[model samples]
Target: MELFNSALGKNITFVHPKFFIIGGLTGIPNITFYYVFLFFVYIVSVVGNTVVMAVIYLDHNLRTPKYIAVFNLAFVDLFGNTALVPKVLDIFLFGHYYIPYNDCLTFLFFCYTCLSLQSFNLVALSYDRMVAIIFPLHYQVKVTHRFMFSFIASLWVFTIIAVLISVGLLTRLSFCKSVVINSYFCDHGQIYRLACNDHFPSYVIACLYPVIIFWLPLAFILLSYLYIGYTLVKVATGEERLKALKTCTSHVILVANFFLPLVGTNIAAVASYIHPNARIINSTLTYTIPALLNPIIYALKTEEVMNAVKKLWKKKTFINTA
Candidate 1:
């Protein structure tokens, strides 16, 4: 855990460690290539998620409860990538590896908050889908804009409270040595691993945190989908069942896109035999790749979004021709 040594022929006792971020310590032959790749991902994530949010905001047809949830997810993705990728770029492209203590904590706070918000948003989207499929007649009556807004607001408040409690606990831990985090960005697990004091409380919180934030929401989503499936099966019309299943396809894809990398990263974290570089790589991809792909997946697979894009493009073309 001793991270520094003074070579002045004297014993050095006091050292305040500034975190050294080693971006994916994979020992790639060409680091610049990796930097360029990450830069492209950053740009795509920002632009794609921004465009998704903008389209959702401007289009009146997209102002439903489902698309409102999509808008929130896009916003979270945009905010998260903005908070994380620039610092990663600084580390890989500009060689600025030293992060101050407070800055590191701030980054970890926002990253955790955004991720937790996304999980809650997904649960909201699943509920929206369930209501739409199971009770189409009552969907409008029950899932009003006012209700959706209140639900989303409550989710934000809950996520903020949960993340603050966790981050507040994190800030109290002492980091006397071993400040080098072997990842591209400041992550909760990485930061907690470097604590020099009694981190039992933090460790307990960490173990329980994912269960509350991620798995619970995921379980709700699965149950919603299960109910939707049962409802579809009871429907006598083949076309109705197909339509219902089609509506759920994009959400299922999105859920897989977000959760697979997360599960992989968590697995790597606890597997002691895994390489540090592999763990770092998994963690980096867990956040960044999902942020980059979420919008793409929706635009390509979701019929409503694609129709919106086409309509917008046609309108632009008509205006240009006129």
Candidate 2:
């Protein structure tokens, strides 16, 4: 747990531990159970995201640009869960926080790409919904399958450029002093803080990327929903109107689940910057809580997926009975 140390006449403090949670001490009751629980969680996350994507693929009715965007979002979630959860499960299993510098850098890049791309995917989904609701008659023509594919491909390109810029900047930073990362995962902000040299460029890029990418898209979602709501209120009336309203409710719920925690995480980061103790709250929100909430959101929002799962279970049950 030493923060700084010297090894063989050279300063070496890369593996020092700095912070400890109150309940994370060794010799806690049944610590093996936590790893078991984390394994189950990872399984559920991967399965849920995979099933959602599959449902969108196999169901012909679900083959629209709106659902295409959803499929991409689900794909992002798949990668996102993989990036963080397995490493976390390993940490829980081993009770060690050893991460090699090169591995750490690669892990950070992959993790950042997943999280950042997921954010972008959600924004794309929102915009897709906005266009459909705003122009129902022209929706099919405007957002052709070709257009959707092109858009998604562009996103992958842009994300790679953005991530390369961030990771490339981080690589240029001098890690002269030490290397041990404090958290269960190597978060970008936390890793940036570890650099013994100046990190001004890293700071500017981190702050600007989130603002331009996440916040602006969130604002667009809010604006799009408001317009949709106004349009719905003006036109909706009977059972058909009620059905029309239901179309967006699921998306709104998904958007809220996707966005609100992130907003909270950003706020927590600000609070931590000001108060220091608030980083725990920030870390919990960003890393721990999101892992559980994402699958739940998809399960609750996608009724078609729920129905398919139900059908799948019933079929398995019938076969077993026979």
Candidate 3:
């Protein structure tokens, strides 16, 4: 056992002790109920996102540059949720609580990548809205399919590269002790906290990464909306102004829904006084809640999506009556 531990430790600097998830520690009287609730949420998120993508793809009218961004956002939500939630369920329900060291790092990489992509995609959506609202005359000329495709490609490439660099930096850290991560899944901050070596550089990068990935895009979205607001005010027609405002509102809601929980999760993770259960719940919600809500928010709030859904429902009802 000593030789096996030594060999494994030599290859991978740290092997974590079996980590306890927040869901398991929430002190709920009936743990089975919590697992059932989470399982239901996971199923809803998957089905909801998949339906959004299908609706967008099947409806030829909805396939605009703007909806393309929406489609991509839904895709990210689905991908991100799928990547994290199953492992969380495994930990909570199946008692597969101990994640191998390398597996944890791999999951962390994809989670961060999805988060970065989601943020960048939101920024792209803001830009799409900005152009459509502020420069409607030139929007067609400016925001081409080619341009949107290239922009999305660039977002994926950039995020993948950034995550790679971050993971590379993480690899350099030594974890001599088996630490227990308090949260569900492998949260970046929680993983970083477990490192036995000097974490100053990792800490610096971790702090800066959220700023670059989350806040910077958030700032861009806000600035774009500010200009959008300014442009809406100058519009002479009340009808046009209302229409423009309605278009941007959904994007704004989605942005808030995604970022607020994200920021809150980070805060709860770092704040010493915050309960571990709260941090875990926050982290779990940060991924699952957004995934479940994205489709519902877009479907209800965005006019095109609502119309498409109505049309599809009518078509199905008509067929049934026939």
Most lDDT-accurate candidate: 1
Estimated TM-score for each candidate: 0.88, 0.79, 0.86
Clashing pairs in 2: none
* Ten-residue region with minimum lDDT total, candidate 2: 1-10
Every model: Cα RMSD to truth = 6.4, 6.9, 4.7
Cα lDDT, all candidates: 0.80, 0.67, 0.79
Tens digits of lDDT, candidate 2, 100-192: 665666677777777777777777777777677668898878888898888888988888788777766666566655565555566667677
Better of 1 and 2 by lDDT: 1
Candidate 1 weakest lDDT stretch, 10 residues: 1-10
lDDT of 3 by residue, 111-146 (tens): 888878888999999999999888889999999888
Number of clashing pairs, model 1?
A: 0
Better of 1 and 3 by TM-score: 1
TM-score between candidate 3 and the true structure: 0.86
Error of 3 at 77 (Å): 0.8
